[model samples]
Target: MPKHVWITRGLAAIAVGGLLAATACKPGDGTSGAGGELDGVTLTVAAKWTGTEQKNFEEVLDGFEKDTGATVNYEATGEDTGAYLGPKIEAGEPPDIAALPQPGLVREYAEQGALKPLQGEAATALESNYTGYWRDLGSVDGEAYGVLLKAAHKSIIWYRPSAFDAAGVTPPETWDELVDTTSRTLSNAGITPFAMCGASGWTLTDWFENAYLSHAGPENYDKLADHEIPWTDDTVVQTLTTLSEVWGEDDMMKGGQKGAVQTAFPTCVSEVYGQEEAAMVFEGDFVGSSAAEAGATVGEDAVAFPFPAVGDKAPVVVGGDIAVAMTERKGVQELMAYLASPQAQSTWAGLGGYLSANSGVQPDAYADEFTQDLSATIVEAGENVRYDLSDQVPSRFGATEGRGMWSILQDLLRGSTDPEGAAKALEKAASEA
Candidate 1:
């Protein structure tokens, strides 16, 4: 059986907390420590994957190594990384290449001269193949530093088809309607309308950013990128207000407020598809697989839809993927070139469940309808594609100061802080950072 998943609020907090811990370390240029001769032969790669993830990466790297006659060394720490690769890098033993989920962190390293600029064919491939928002994730100050490898769809709401059918509940089309539906589910059906795992700082942060995008418009996130906007903006206040009301309702979320605090991450996912009575969950597309891995029949039993529109704006999604680069070995350049190629992208999608970043590169292996539809949604997103705000924000500010926004929400839920007070608290954090 698959691992019992806990998508708890605590896990989310720990994940972000791990990244935040990396902020205080002294920087390194990934130079080989101990004055060892720099070999242009082996590429020590550190990725955020282990077990099946490690196996999949090894397959791709093995192909690259075999085709190019290069030595490839791979290590995966998975999600248990505390300070990530920061201390190892600081000790002068940094992996020649590392694939990280946070592009904002990658950009910080690049700014400190830790990352080499990816140019020529690699840059061109990224520009032409990936969506513009994805390209922006790995970019800092107008220069492209990282390659786009995977695209995770975030604007998804996973629900049980059986439950909706039985309860005669329809997926709402607008934010107001969604809120109204939540109330209906509680008052009429006695089911928890929304399942919020707020104890996890990161997951709660998702609510903050998602609601922020709709209430404030996606461009406000871009403004935060440039330090043009404060965390205390009125838009943020509105989002917190909305979440506070919805999440505050008794029996609004399964397990109640206390359960929201204690439940794990995977549990939040399970609340949606674990049973027909659990109802819907607002999370990323990956939640679908989590439900399936937890024993729910995917596609038929569970279905996903975009977060309903909050106002006049179209639905906006948040997500990006990990990008990998091996050492600068002979023909490693060629392999890197190929890694960014459409063929590589197609193959990678076949090996893993993530959406391919290479434009027009659809895989032959059949994926779930939701996955396929999500892929099409990425392609058809036009110019409205926005990445996860917390992922894109600088670690010092984003990881540290920005993540505290979750606690502010909790305070709002408990009626300890009003919208205006919460906004000011966020502004103080942002300004201090």
Candidate 2:
């Protein structure tokens, strides 16, 4: 997962009356010149971003500071933001704003009364920039509290075009076709059919989610995500059985199941692109960057297709960050509103590793044609998009190490458990979580 960060300096304090007058100004109501209404206000923001992502976000913060004259203090605390913020929140000194990646955590904070509802420019900017599905993701009980900042499309299958061409195979269009293609690649080309990153359980969960979403349809996908339907439901069993068609095969995966369980995500990409040991890998658009880092020519040596349809329609699963305000200060709201704007999103998108759900941003904002096409595919999905199911559930059942979906699915791939048994284990975990 990627992180996002922004920082600025604080302004001199203004009188209460002056603050009230400043709050009345809407976004774009005044020229972005010197001596803006928020000239003297300062805010603190925390996120799990560092390195280039932090640098890219700093460009957006610079724009905000120039536009509003407010300063912000930024912190890159890595992925354990809950650990970093928990004590401060308990001590009554939380940051003015925080960029949270998990919608489940956003809902947790909002339900616990630790998050402030978006108002004024922030509220208006989100309404104008994002779609209803995005807006709903940031809301709790019909009240908006967070704004989606960055996004990743998780419904792509990446492969080396040369490998496919050598094997006389084209991108499959349906589940049966995908199976046939895999079999043909193995029998005809003498190469592994799939690069299954079983070591990273989250990747395994994505496989199941993509299959289940198409198998059960959007409504049931939501129900399963919310635990409205038991894991033992027939849809789950069918999904697992469908997945086993490939996972359970003797030589369908690289190094068989054992090799997949030992291979990490980066190595999985390397196997397909660097070593030419595998024919295909299923992952999000972010894999393009990873492939480049591993010395593969993305979009040339490597190309991607939408995950093949298992039912009537293909499904799109997304993962991203949401910016939430912890205080209602004028400067905080102004910063949140700016972050949701096309200008700020475009600045980040130009950095080559960022994507935004904000529909207002133009296609030319991206760094390459492939990214632009990928973003267009996501935008076209619109209301049909679904979030990563494991990320939507409780941390104990979804994110915990050694006990969550990661370990359970690894067991299934290792042939220690069957689909029915795995489904029962998932139900028990969800119930306990």
lDDT of each: 0.61, 0.79
Best by lDDT: 2
Kindly list the per-residue Cα lDDT of model 1 for residues 1-433, writing each as its tens digit: 1221221213233333222221111212111121223234577777777676567767777665554556678877566332767777577566766777777667667766666556555665566556676666777787766766667777767776666666667766667777776447644765666666565556666766766777777677679655698766667767777877666665667766666656557777777765544677777766866888767876666666567767565455656555544244444344455555555555556775667545545423325434555665555565666777777655554555225555665666555677788888867766766
The CA root-mean-square deviation of candidate 2, after full C-alpha superposition on the true structure, stands at 8.9
Give the per-residue lDDT digits (tens) of candidate 2, residues 1-433.
1011000011112112222232223454222323567788888888888887788887778887887778878888678787887888888889998988788989889888999998877788788777788899999999999888989889888887777667777777788888977456654688778888888888988998999988889899999989999999999999998988888875888888788787888779888888888878889988987888878877677778778889887888888888999877767877878887777887888987887777666667787666766666555565568888888999888876688787888888888899999999999999999
Candidate 1 deviant stretches above 4 angstroms: 1-41, 78-82, 182-187, 275-277, 324-332, 363-366, 400-403
Residue 317 of model 1: what lDDT?
Answer: 65
For every candidate in turn, the CA RMSD to the true structure comes to: 9.7, 8.9
User: Could you tell me how far off, in angstroms, the CA of residue 420 lies in candidate 1 after the best superposition?
Assistant: 2.2
Local error of candidate 1 at residue 234 (angstroms): 1.7
